[model samples]
Target: MTTTLAAGPAPVVARPGPDIASRRRRARTRERTAQWLFLVPAIAYVLVFFGYPIVKNFVMGSQDYTVRTFVSGEAPWVGLDNYVEVVTSSIFRTSVVNTALFTVGSIVGQFVIGLLFALFFKRRFPLGNVLRSLLLLPWLLPMIAGTAVWKWILDQDGGVLNEALRAVGLVDAPVHWLTSPDVALVAVVIVNVWVGIPFNMTLLYSGLQNIPEELYEAGALDGATGVKAFWHITWPNLRPVVSVVLVLGVIYTLKVLDIILGLTGGGPAGATETLATDSYRRSFQEFSFGTGAAVSNILIVVSLLFAVVYLRANRRAVDE
Candidate 1:
């Protein structure tokens, strides 16, 4: 056996260049970095403002917290007493009902009126743009100021409403519109409708405008006219918009605070009270943070429920 074979050539070393796995890992890191870079500002804002407040509010709500004692950092633990009080209290339940009332009334009234406007303004007419612009006045005005204007307009003695009523001999005496729960609730609903109409009108009008004119013409040729044509052509096409506006109207009007606050402050018997107003008073005025949080959570639940319903409706519409 001969001899020592020449030593095998020194083992060759592989280059350190990236293999498939390493390359994939590097790419993933780059993508992750890009995602975080894009999200940093939003994350920071939420953490600093919304997130911190929400968490702190939750923590403080569990304690017997108040401004004076909070600074000393010895806030007493109150357990679920706050929650007990909130649910058991008569005020929260009344507010829930009032909110529901306001939302339902406003949405129905606004839809009827907004559909009218959408139909009216659908076609090009003289000064149509001007009319639409003027229609936006209620929506463009600041919420508090706008509601305040309505408040004054509904004032029992000096309101323009009463004045107009008397001028037209519609009433025998001035009505205490805001001082009575029954009337005040109705008045607030009216104000909400006024504010919401322009929004729904504009949105529905845009949706209506998107429909192909040929569809209407075809329906007309088939002897469908007026209400029949609208039922067959317009309503079907505008269904999505209608659903969206109705759902959005429900959500927005449900959380409505300025309108109720400016008009009624939930006065006369909590008849005009809503979850939003109740939450505000509980947290700010009554120093019942837990109760306020509970109300807010309920409000959020209601909104989310409606949102889910709307989305289901939209999906069904799409599937059809």
Candidate 2:
């Protein structure tokens, strides 16, 4: 005990070796440099394309920029005139209603069809792979080609749909699917649903795949089976994926341009003119860029609202 003298204050620990610290600093610098090198192309692309266009659109919308009101020099600002005109105008009002109908209809139809196909594919039956690929064929086709094919099927006089109806004696006359204002919207929605179904199926199928079989086994132990298991486990698991798919579908359906332009050109007295088509018609067709841009901005606002809601839902899902 007497020999165990108290130790003196501990020697000041040497700082890290200079070479080791230097090597770490160099390694960190290299890593940072590599990260920036990888990000350079992406940063450049965003600034050039997305950033520039967004800024330009806002700037262009601000000025009296229509072909009618345009001048080479700085444009005179017309405060709220474009907004007022678009809101008050009759065609614009009609366009708003049609857009609403088309959006809701497409979402409903696409959702139903997509859900069915997704469920069908989840079972992994024989030929499921072949069927899955074939199902995606419509989605893969060029927009122009897909529209052309639908045009053939929907041709009032000589279309295959009419021929089949006649052969089956389902109706007396070949239904003028596209020409009639009443049915034209529905027809376009049908095409959209059919085309969009594959995407929904694919996304949902993947989500379904991620559901652990252990959950189902656990449920079975509790006497849960079939639809009950699906509701309790499968649905909870897929809800996150479903939210994303539907929100994206809403956005995609809202911007449905080529299909409407290709099929009907918003014809039969503007029955099929969605907000997107209306924007195109006003801007390009009539050279009213300001008004078109306003409509576009409105669409963007709507999309943003949906995005916000979807993001909130996703955050909640992750927390759960």
Candidate 3:
């Protein structure tokens, strides 16, 4: 009864040696390398396509690059002379004014109309989806084709718009939509707004969709309904989305060339000329590549400033 089994020795767990630890470190390094390898294609694509063009533009902006430069194979370095000429030119003032008016008018029209449409479509109705899909036609159509059709519609004579106005007694004669310098800028802005409306509507609709229904219901219970509710509840929630839409609208409107070019060709005596068209004219039409590059570089700087502002605002929104 007093006999007991002898105690067995403690089993020693093997500690990782230097070799095993080194092998583990190597495996981790390999895993990280594999992860970064997946990004190579994207990085290379950006560097080749975006980086090269931007760098070339910057170089061209600093030199006297032109048609003759092509023949001579010598682009004499001019430093900021191109920029100075661009800024001091008489056309520069007109382009700046037109650009500002075009941008502001287009954004305001697009945002207002798009917001109205989005609010309208947000309500459940018969064939709402169909109508919403139809609204995207402007955005989906080819820019050149759309602007061409718009040109015909806005023509001074034998145009649908003039005919409609005359038929309705709104105008006694054809209004020179595209031919008059005074109205050409307005016409271009109208076309741009038409093309841009669907984009704003789509983005704003998505943002509206994300707002919680409970917040609205709660607001209603407190007697904040309709406009008041929208102001106090909906607007506060939608401000971040609004900021994004506005910034993007400004950026896109700033560089719009096709709409203006197709509709006005930067004329009726350069009435609708913007920075974009001016740059194109300087480089291709006039063959002053340096000046064109300089104008474009200025545009790039403006766009970058807006982009910076957008990033900061977005970060703030996220933090809140």
Candidate 4:
């Protein structure tokens, strides 16, 4: 009849074997793999440069590693003897105390001064960018060079700092900034603080810039301005960055060697001898590699403990 009796079931149309989602999934996987391939070189470089030394240090800490081990490659296992000796040594307590003081002092000075500088830079002014760039010179200079310059500035008799103090009538006699045990650590801390300030200021300023002007404007409408606005808006917004800066500063300051070594050489009756310098003395100077590794391992643990505390505090802050 008219329709050829039901048209024998409409002709079947061919459909794609895979769903759109499936095709997209395959494409995303390929893209991710390609992106990861680009990162392989960087990952490998880090493993070779950082990972190997960490592992080697751990192994050495557990063995009777020495200068001879480097030549003969025969390091006998000594278990925790190295650690025991390091912990019991007379210098251990002093080094620990010095390490704590150095890290705390440097971090406090750096963060406080850096925050002030960052706030100063936030204000609009002529040549502001140029001034900020110039501030980075101290940070850009090599650590040894900065330390050498600082040594001259803090020298006992002929240093500029002493001369300035003498001119200003701050003291009766030239101060022994590096030689006197009482003030050597202070001098080292001052130099470290100077070198670290630019880094902190740059990071903090970046954080401040990331904040939207709209937030400040809105807060201003709600009777929030100046110090009040900073407490309510700026501080809250800057907390995460501040946390990172503090934690990184602690880690870096804990391992500071160049400035201390160049300035005081951990001398004047070991006034400036922190764990880092002590570790260096043991390994390179005294050729007690195992003891040096042990001290370094302790430092690593301290750094890790601090990082853990910071993470917990950050989590609590986020939750609240």
Record all residue pairs in model 4 with backbone atoms less than 3 Å apart, i.e. clashing. Answer: none
- The TM-score measured for candidate 4 stands at 0.91
Q: What's the distance in Å from true for residue 247, model 1?
A: 2.5
lDDT of 1 at 267: 92
Off by over 4 Å in 3: 1-15, 310-320
Q: Estimated TM-score per prediction?
A: 0.83, 0.91, 0.91, 0.91
Poorest 10 consecutive residues of model 1 by lDDT?
Answer: 61-70
lDDT of each: 0.86, 0.86, 0.93, 0.94
Per-residue lDDT of 11 in model 4: 81
245: Cα error in model 2, Å: 0.7
Model 4 misplacement above 4 A: 1-15, 18-36
lDDT of 3 by residue, 125-207 (tens): 99999999999999999999999999999989898999999999999989999999989999999999999999999988998
RMSD of 3: 3.8
| lDDT tens readout by residue for model 2, 67-168 | 656555656687677778778888887888888888888788877778878878888689989988999998899999999999999999999999999999
How many Å off is the CA of 9 in candidate 1? Answer: 35
Worst 10 residues of 3 by lDDT: 309-318
Q: Give one digit per residue, the lDDT tens place, for model 4 in 228-305.
A: 999999999999999899999999999999999999999889899999999999999999999999999999999999
Ranking by lDDT: 4, 3, 2, 1
